[model samples]
Target: MRKVILSGMLCCALTATFTIDAVAANSALVSPDRRISVALFIDAHDQAQYQISHDRQPVLLASGLGLALSDRQFLNNIRSIKPSDITEINEHYQLYSGKQSQVDYSANQQQFVLTNDKMQQLEITFRVSNDGVAFRYRALEDKRIDKQSPKPVSVVEEYTRFNLPQQSRAWLQPIAEAQTGWEHTNPSYEEHYQMDIPVDQPSTSPAGWVFPALFKIGNKTDNTWMAITEAGVTANDHASRLQARSPKGEYAIGLPMAAEVFTGKALLSHDTLPLQTPWRVIAIGSLATIADSTLGTDLAEPSAMDTRFIKPGIASWSWGLLKDDATVYSVQQQFIDHAADMHWQYTLIDADWDQKIGDDKLKQLVDYAAGKNVGIWVWYNSSGAWNTTKYSPKSRLLTAETRQQEFAKLHNLGVKGVKIDFFAGDGQSMMAYYHDILNDAAKYELLVNFHGTTLPRGLSRTYPNLLSAEAVKGFEMITFFQEAADKEASHSAMLPFTRNLFDPMDFTPTTFNDIPNIKRKTTNAFELALPILFVSGIQHIVETPAGMKTVPTFVKSVMQQLPTHWDESRFIAGYPSKLAVFARRAGDTWFVAGINGEAEAKTITLDLSFLQTMGGNIEMIVSDGERGFQTHKVVLSAKTEIKLQGNDGFIIRITPKS
Candidate 1:
């Protein structure tokens, strides 16, 4: 074991790990690969601050760190600072969801102990990994004080900051004001992103910005891409967002809104002694590294329950296209048959199933689907005083008893999962409510999908039963509004790098057929590419059976064989909100997919040498203008040129040579 101790004097260097016993004002913890470093120090004003750099290039400037408790300020007026020995951590974990099935995690960790003038002790721990860094804090009780019965302590505010460089650019989604949007169901993390804006720009939403926030620092030639988010958020903690005001490019953490709590629950977070906050993760590197990094899940708590009932597959959802009328028994039966015909594992019966389809008919439909080896999923309104959404099956899941009763009934009806929608914002109470629902659902062996909800924030790893969450402004928005459709290309392109980086996003991707009363902007090829491009545990596809009949046979075959759970994923090419290209593998087959988000046709040349080294046969399926597909066999080479039509996409499937 190696240690770097910081006592009272400032020290900065790029050296290998060695034991140093000296009084230092600052301590630098370098990554295992030595390419990333985090500096933790107490400044001249006696305030705790930190900095991050990649390859000696500044990624985040000196940022303040501390929090205010109801009793007093925690990190200010630091009396003494002591550092612990550096511990090397190397481990491997397996997950059934997200971009990869198995992950190898390596990091170097050190703890900083600080005591304020009030004799309050706070421990801040930093873990530096090759791809990025993560830090968290624990408020401890001082042994000198007389021990008494512990009482709840409120977290007044956190002063953590992420100060970007002046020239840095950002792509962030402004969180909606609580109780503002449709039926007071605002701040669902569904707002559109402000693409490639300056880091100093204030957010349009007075509430703040949502995570994971993407940024590009340094000059264009020497740019370092980064994303900021939090993980391992348990019910003991409240979820947070970026504060709206960023004075001098310094972004602070903001707690949830007053109305963001569950009805009759606390808005602020309260906990007893030894309070541990969630890990603040900053993924820093090239765009590829940012896309491929699993720091979010890497810092999260492992799965708590069995995953035998967790199955990853696609679902045929008619509500995205057919609306409320599609909830009828006949239409649902058609979708079940459609799923069976396409070899999909599930068919989703959306909102209003209780009144429209009724219990008797829904049971028959479930039995019918089961006979064909297909499962059924239903929807519910997270109804209470939280939102005024008039959807049916409401008020059935506001309490644990009622929620479990509903889940038990659904399990008896052969329902595989439940899509709970229209939740309140990210208050501590609502965060606990999310965990409650997942826990109750898991008891009855049911999968969970949250809509109109907060970001998963690595919950899929914590609870394997949680397959996906609809935090993005999904395809349902595109079907209802023309403006949303117009911005579809760019918004979809941004998700792979930002929203969908680690979480399983239920974007309800792909609709090759034209939507009613809305002009479809993305080409069929772009829509075709989505199934492979987007990663979701239970991908609820929006295309109808009639729409499927219009595509080429090869395209249909590719859709049928798409894998929801991937063995490995790599970023091949492209930029944020403009173009995205990715290669994902399942077993021995590889699926290379890309989309051009610009209005003009874009040409992309991919380096297929990595895939070629494995010796495989390739088939390229690309767009033929707006509504058709062009399929052909291609030879893998070092450089392969691919021309994508405006608002178009392509997918290249590689199989091991027989």
Candidate 2:
């Protein structure tokens, strides 16, 4: 029934010969720089399988792809397979709202078109960069006599699986959600990470493991590292996690059977055609390439708004320091004055500001902050309800009209940004709401920050005003749990490689206080380095004006001038739950932070070659054991070894000496 055809698709670094069979075909593509390659083949039955390699060494085993629909039609039949398109994208796009000022988005693109017996089509598009590889599924309309939609297509599950070699291992954080009195099916993306976990091992959680799964492909130094994450996330789609598959297939893209319930209503996504899914990405290369991969942003849509008004900087938050008791104007003014004193850009006036201060008084506070040369960021509950047990405020911005009105009011009130909290989950309805809010927020010139919501999947790229998100087990957890500060050292070490892979984390960094009244587990130096170590478009650090006076003068200086984004980022040493060392350059100046997780002292050898040629003298500060916060004058060189105490941290600032 099908004709056999052979063709060749020439890529940037290599040419893949396509061989056609009675039912399927096979081909291969390589990364633009010739470091990575993927071999794709369709069997006689029309099922598609792909494998990845680095420098000619197999890194990813053969993996199948398909999507199952509720209509009893499996989109597994490869009706026809051939080269779709090849493009070379080389451009530097600026993020009006992100941690990095500019991003280098360059990749070589290739695609494969697959169709089923029902005449329906699914296109798999792949982009290979020098550092990573990404692919996404786009559902197309069937072209046969009765193949179009009005009678739409609904997908139940995506049958994409990640099969790994037997020796490979992953750094996993099992996804969990509570189902009953004692347990949950999803961890709400709050669980601690388990490092170097074998891929074949069994896990207890049925919901599977949280994505952005980092894998160590082999023992080689140059070519065998990989990180699996998703991009181009939309509200129209549900979250995807990796579940263990036995007997051969190592892991799979799993569908969460349960939905998130808000106000007693369950939220689930029923994706329909004319639909496209998020990009499933694999960053493959050396650890440095995998650590600093920007493929996620490449997979996300570009900025949809004018970003001039949406500037990125740090905000002095009131909630972490004063909590509910500080809702009044005087306390809020103290925060503003504190932010102003430190020359920080913004002051966040948290929840209940409306009820506590009222309109006439709130505007005066906004005016006062403006006079201090500081911007205002007010908090609003996205659903508009505070608590179920007590009286709740009606959601004023649920609809388009209300959102426009509310945003206009804030813009008129001179508010720079809005921190919207408590999203329902990753549902089509909620994701649609995100798009609407961002579109409307731009109209009022209001910058945005998402709190108590889903992890970023390149939304910040699409909406630069959407600055930061609180989606992980951040410092705030200490407010409720006693064990929080104890786990701070280890948890902090794991973030950069895992939770921070695809988005800016608002974990609302804490520097003034480690935890209320718990002997500070991490030293003052460690606390101080956070503003630099943690990457957020808006580094919302929690430290009151009075409390901030106790910090070292230079630490305060660095905090005040800390660039929320960077020109470059490099991973230096250590793995999850062990150590994390990194260097970031904002311009001529370089900032570096390193923290140790174990209880014993350890030394790290840092490579300063990135700062080479740009001659600069280094001024270093460390928080090792009881050394307190002391500055050391050290000569700048390519290699420097430093020691840290158990539960310690180190930070250094490099400036060119005249």
Give the least accurate 10-residue stretch of model 2, judged by summed lDDT.
Answer: 385-394
Off by over 4 Å in 1: 1-27, 144-146
lDDT of 2 by residue, 1-658 (tens): 1222312452121123432121122345667776677756664455776777777677777677777655534345666555655778787777643446688888878777666776676777888789888898877655553244445445577877777776776787766553321122123466667777777775557767777788887542534678887888775666676874433426788765345433343244445555678889888877677667777677788775777787787889888856788888888888888888878889888777788876678789889999998999888877632223111123766879988998898899888988887665455556677788888999999888876666677788888888887777787776656687788888888788777866888888766544567656777776776767778888888877767777778767777777757777777776777788888888778888888877678877777776667776777988634435788765445677888888788888887787
Off by over 4 Å in 2: 1-27, 70-76, 96-99, 146-149, 178-187, 202-204, 219-223, 244-249, 261-273, 384-394, 512-514, 624-627
Instruction: Give RMSD to native, each candidate.
Output: 3.6, 4.3
Q: What is the C-alpha lDDT profile of model 1 across 346-403, one tens digit per residue?
A: 9999998999988888899999999999999999999699888999899999988888
Alpha-carbon lDDT of model 1: 0.86
Clash pairs for candidate 1: 7-24, 8-24, 8-25, 9-24, 9-25
lDDT of 1 at 268: 72
Instruction: Tell me the RMSD of model 1 versus the true structure.
Output: 3.6
TM-scores for the candidates:
0.96, 0.90
So what's the TM-score on candidate 2?
A: 0.90
TM value for model 1: 0.96
